[model samples]
Target: MVELLNAPNIDQYAWGAINGCEAASLLEGLHCLGKLTNVNYGEFLKQMPIDEGGNPNYGFGGSPYKNQAGKFEAIFVKPLADWAANYTTYEDLSDSGVEPIYQSVEAGNPVVTYVTVHFEKPEIETYPFGDVAINNHAVLVDGVNATQVHLSDPIDGKYYLDKSKFEKIYLSRNMALALLK
Candidate 1:
């Protein structure tokens, strides 16, 4: 994350100017370019939102949405099912067990992985509300311990999730992205 926020010559390593598009549009175009195939993590942070003045939304790191970082996660993973047929082979996720699923390692392509993102409405939140209306956002799981999922809301920038507090959440979507490894 630090590297993407500070990297010089980032445009040379990847296309899509940071300020060029909203998260959804940027993800869609990159998926079309074939530059973002199954690869994960390596180039993702580059597409993160920058303020109109070309500054990182520093508040983001401290926001309640931090762990619940869905916009980016969903934007990254939404297009993979379309990109799958382009893969010469398919890998199964059932074997990944409790770990996040890992897939793809093709030359000139990004190694991508898929993970499910679960969310819940905010009516049940106990935290004090501020700039972000918790009711408007989804829950982001912050920890994974066997059958348990931990979540954080970036708006608070503090992780306050517990195993049982989030049953109100639902699976909003499945995410896919290229992995650095």
Candidate 2:
């Protein structure tokens, strides 16, 4: 199934008002799987851990919070998990992370994941968290075919990617993801 989340619109906390793409995908993924309902980016922003660094702490648009990649759990995933239905957050980072993602989708959980905004962007932007390209985006992985996972990108909308091509982007940023099951 294809899924999508509305990008944030707040300029200060996001690339725009829709800066919480990762959070957005998390909400949509869980909802699509019936693990959560009615949550959105505004809810994520409201629940995300707050700090003096504000937007950067949340790494809105892939920019680091005061140059730090905010804790994916505290700043993003866990809070959502607390609101979901019969699901717990389990991490499956690397170690063939792609397979676990597909497994989770098959087992009735979609992955809320991190990826570059675009597959072709160069890692040129500097941040205290680390150097990054423009679109450190968040998405939902709910369906898979033989070689690719179907995902919903908040900024780019819904699409599929070559499994190998998807891994290059996911692994680049530590294979960031949250699984709700």
Candidate 3:
């Protein structure tokens, strides 16, 4: 199964007119998963997931919002044939640290998967910026795996994300359904 996660360098995602909610909507519309920061989460623990040790893992759950609830919800997954049909096998990716956006890593072709929209806050620090919080950006999860996935921001920058962080941010089936249409 493929999962999508938000990159650490979310600050550099500034592009186009779409907002965080809009970007998420676009990804969900495509039936693809997205990894992004929940801007409403706030600072200190702003969009950062806490580890067992209580240290911020810098990760959080992700999902599609503003769309019809049952449209993407599938009944069952056929293992090898229909990975997309099963919601449990698939996961939404994200991280509290800066990471890159991607879809999949199948050979050389990078296919676009989901769309992400993030809001930028100046209080947090992030890549391409120092001392300034660079949060709130959107990325499309085009492809992925246990290693990395292909990602593209609206500004046309492409990159990859490690799998460990990808596992950190995922929405539960119930959580996903709550955000769906």
Best by TM-score: 2
Deviation in Å, model 3, residue 164 alpha carbon: 2.1
Compared with the true structure, what per-residue lDDT tens digits does model 3 show for residues 132-160?
22232334444576676445454444466
lDDT of 1 by residue, 101-164 (tens): 2112222122232221223442332222222323333222223333344322222222333334
Please give the TM-score that candidate 2 achieves against the real structure.
Answer: 0.66
Better of 1 and 3 by lDDT: 3
Writing each residue's lDDT as its tens digit, candidate 2 over 40-119 gives: 55655565444344333343323222333532212343333444323445554444556677766766666776677667
How many clashing residue pairs appear in each of the predictions shown? 26, 13, 35
On lDDT, the leading prediction is: 2
Query: Which residue runs of candidate 2 sit more than 4 Å off their true CA positions?
Result: 1-16, 54-87, 92-96
TM-score of each: 0.26, 0.66, 0.28
TM-score of 3: 0.28
In model 1, the Cα lDDT at residue 105 comes to: 20
Give the range where candidate 1 is weakest over 10 consecutive residues by summed lDDT.
1-10
